[model samples]
Structure formats: structure tokens, C-alpha cells
Target: MHELTTVTDSAAAQLQQVRDLVALLDDAQYVRRPPGASSVAGHVRHCVDHYAALLAGAERGTVDYDRRERGGALETDRTLALARLDVVRSRVRALAPGVLDRPVEVSGIVDARGTVARSRSTVGRELLFVAHHAVHHLALMMPVVRTLGVSVPADLGYAPATMAFLRQRDGGTPA
Candidate 1:
């Protein structure tokens, strides 16, 4: 098992990257859903929904990722999206240290047919999942941002494990 603090810290860093990305974009860019791509605000809202589900479920011992607030201001309004970004980050960081060890029942839509998969997990594990979920969405958003002529962090979309490997292979430098 991994140390919960380490997992949370890395997750926080990932979210911070997202915050930085949003700060760099203009109002139009933030809400622009590029052709065949999701908008930056869309990704932020989706991530917040997962984080919200995790936070809500942590208290009850069951997390339903399928419970999402799809579309609306969160996906269109930059101000709302930015506020949610901060709130989710604060909520994530404020999670009780011991809560990570608590058991949680998890559920999510798994297929095109809308099948739901169920499983047992710990809050620490769910935190990792939700954070990585955001990172993957960030991956999709990065290319869209790039095509719009905006600069972004080189390591924006990489998984924590991949980032560690990159630093190691590159002699402690981000490459």
C-alpha cells in the first residue's frame, strides 16, 4: 500500500497544473470546445463531479462516479469552472488523513450499454483514481490548447508514475 499523504500530494500537484492551465487561457479559450475535442471548462467540470462524488461518498462509504452534473454553467462559464477548480482542490486537500484508509464501495458506468461495475476500495485508492481521471482529461485538453497557440506545461498530461520514471531516466530533471 502507498502512503496516503504521498498520493494526495501528487494529486494536489496534478490539480495545481490544471489551475495553472486555466489561468493561462482567455475567456473564449476556456469555454471553446474545439472540433472533436472537449472544452477546458468541460474537463474541469467533469473532474469536479468525480471529486464531488468521492467527497460525498467518503462520508457514507460508497462512491458513485456515475452521479455526474453533465453540461450547464460548469461546462460553459469560466468563472464557475475556476471557482469549482479551487473548491475541489481545497476539498481534496482538506480530506482527513485517516479517511484514506476507510473502506469505500465504488461504482461506475463501464460500457456503451451503460452497464455499471461495482467494487470494493479505499478512499486513498479512490483519490488516486479520481486524480488520474482528471489527468487523462487534461491529456485531451492539452492538444486542444496547443492548437490554439497557447503554451502549457510539458508534463501536463503524464501520469504520476510516468512522471517519476521520466525524472529518474533524465537524471532528476523533468524531461
Candidate 2:
């Protein structure tokens, strides 16, 4: 059997990147721009909340993350969201190696048809998914950042070889 090691360290590093990005964003960037779109910061807050749920489920052995009904709490304020982000990061980092040996229980609508689904996977896989999810959204956010004349980190995974070629073509240092 291929033993799966906990990706807690890499997750921690990604969380640090998220925190850095959050620090760099101002109120205008954090708030919603489009009438129907979620704010960029709101998406990060949602990702942190997902991490909190995953951590809780890992500890308790079960959780229903797909439940859309309010779980008896008001919407968290930005300060509270940041606090929860810190706590979730600490929890993931502190988890024992063996903790990820088992699969993670997750429930949610896997599609747009409003059908709810349940599944399980190793904690390491789940963390990898979460990291990639953040990367996916972060890329979508690049245009928004560029519109503000801010340069994003090139190492945010744009195929290093391609980036190097583009930089060389553009007469700049290869990233």
C-alpha cells in the first residue's frame, strides 16, 4: 500500500500565501465588484470555513458539510473570519500524521442540479484538492488584480517553462 503522508506542511505554506494576499488587499478589492458575484475576500472566507469543517469532521469522525441550513450562527464578520482562518491553519498543522491515514467524510452537491452527494477520501487528498481549489480561484482573481495595476506573484503556478519563455520573449528576466 502506498502510505499517504499528511500534507499539513504544504497546506500551512499555502495558508501563509493566502494571509499575505489578504494583507495586500484593501477594502475595495475585498468587497464585491459585480452585482451578483461574491467578493474575493468572501471566497477566501468560504475556503477557510471549509477547512474548519474538514478539521472538525476529522476530529469527530463525521460531519455534513452540504447542509445549507444555517447552523445557528450569524454570518461571521471579517475579523472573526480571519481569526477562524488562523485557528483552522493551526489545527491542520497540529494534526497527527496518522490522522490523515483514514478517509475524510464530505457531503455536498457535486453538480448544479441541486443533487446532494456524499463521499470519502484520504485527508491528504482532500487537502490537495483544497490547495488546488484555492489556486484555481486565485488565477481567476489575477485579472482583477491587474486591472488595479498590481503585479501578481509569477510562481503562482503558471507552468514555469512557459513563463520563462514568455519572459524571455518579452525581454524581461525569466521568472
Candidate 3:
């Protein structure tokens, strides 16, 4: 339960940071594209899409990362994105501890031939994966945010282990 809570809280915090950053951007900043780079809106949409997929999988026994709603209003409307973030955060917080260890089927591409592979996983593991996925996308968003002159927290996109290591190196106790 503790581990589940930690992961949920971490995810919630990451989403909150995203919400904060997005709140500072106008529509142009949110949707602006640099050459060969994804827009800030696109990154936010991708992260939220994964959370939606993970939550859907938690309800069913199968998880498919490839099944996603791409380029919806979530990628353009900040209010819509924040609303979805709230819903995902709430759903994550409401996950039952008993369901954390339940077996689940995870499907994804595994080979150069684009063959879909299926494997067994647990809800807890998938939650951790989603959290990490959010962090990964957030890291990618950092440069976009900076280019837009938006400042976010230093730990906004760091993993738990990375944050702890950074804290220790800075002569602070590990978070």
C-alpha cells in the first residue's frame, strides 16, 4: 500500500507540475512547434494518453500501450488537458491496494518486424511504468518550456532515484 501510494502521489505531483506550467502558456506557446520538435501540447497529450491507457487496463485485465487517442483537443486546449489530468489523478489515488498485485496482460511491439508481444504484468508494476513514462515526457518538455521562457521546478521531471541522488549530492538528505 505504501509503495502504491508513493507511485500515485508521484504521478499526481508530476501532473500538477504540468498543469502549472501549462497555465503559464498561451495557446500559441502551448501549440507552437520548433523545427523537428514536438509541441508542448503534444507532449502533454502523450503523457495523459498513457495514464488513460493504464487506467483502462487497470479496469480490464489487459493493457495495450499502442491503443491511444491521438491528437484530440487535449493537445490544444489547456483547460481540457487540466480536466483530464484531474480525472487521471483522482483515478490513480482511488486505486485499491488489493488490486495492485493482480495479474494483467500487457501488449506492445517487441520486434523489428513490428510483431505485437504480450506478457504478464501486475497493476502495481504498470502504475510504476506510467509514472516513469510521465517523467520521461516531462523531461522532454523541459527544453520546450525553457524556450518559451517558462520556469518549472528543478525536480519536476526527475525520477525518484534521480531526485534522491541529486539531493544527496547537494548535501541534503535523500528525499
Name the top lDDT candidate. Answer: 1
Give the alpha carbon lDDT tens digit for every residue of 1-175 in model 3.
3777777777777777777777878888889877778998999899888888888898899999889989989888878887888888788888877787888999998888989999999988888898888788877887887887876766666667788887778955433
What's the CA error at residue 135 for candidate 2, in Å?
A: 1.7
- Model 2 misplaced regions, further than 4 Å: 1-6, 34-37, 68-79, 111-113, 157-175
> By descending lDDT, how would the candidates be arranged?
1, 3, 2
- CA lDDT, candidate 2, residue 28: 61
Q: Let me know the TM-score candidate 1 reaches against the reference structure.
A: 0.91
- Candidate 1 lDDT score relative to the true structure: 0.85
lDDT of 1 by residue, 45-115 (tens): 88888988999999999999888789878877777777877888888888777989999999888999999
RMSD of each: 2.1, 4.9, 2.4
Candidate 3 residue 167 Cα shift, in angstroms, is 1.0
Candidate 1 vs candidate 2, TM-score winner: 1
Residue pairs with colliding backbones in model 3 are: none
Lowest lDDT sum, 10 consecutive residues, model 1, at 166-175
Runs of candidate 3 with Cα error greater than 4 angstroms are 111-113, 172-175
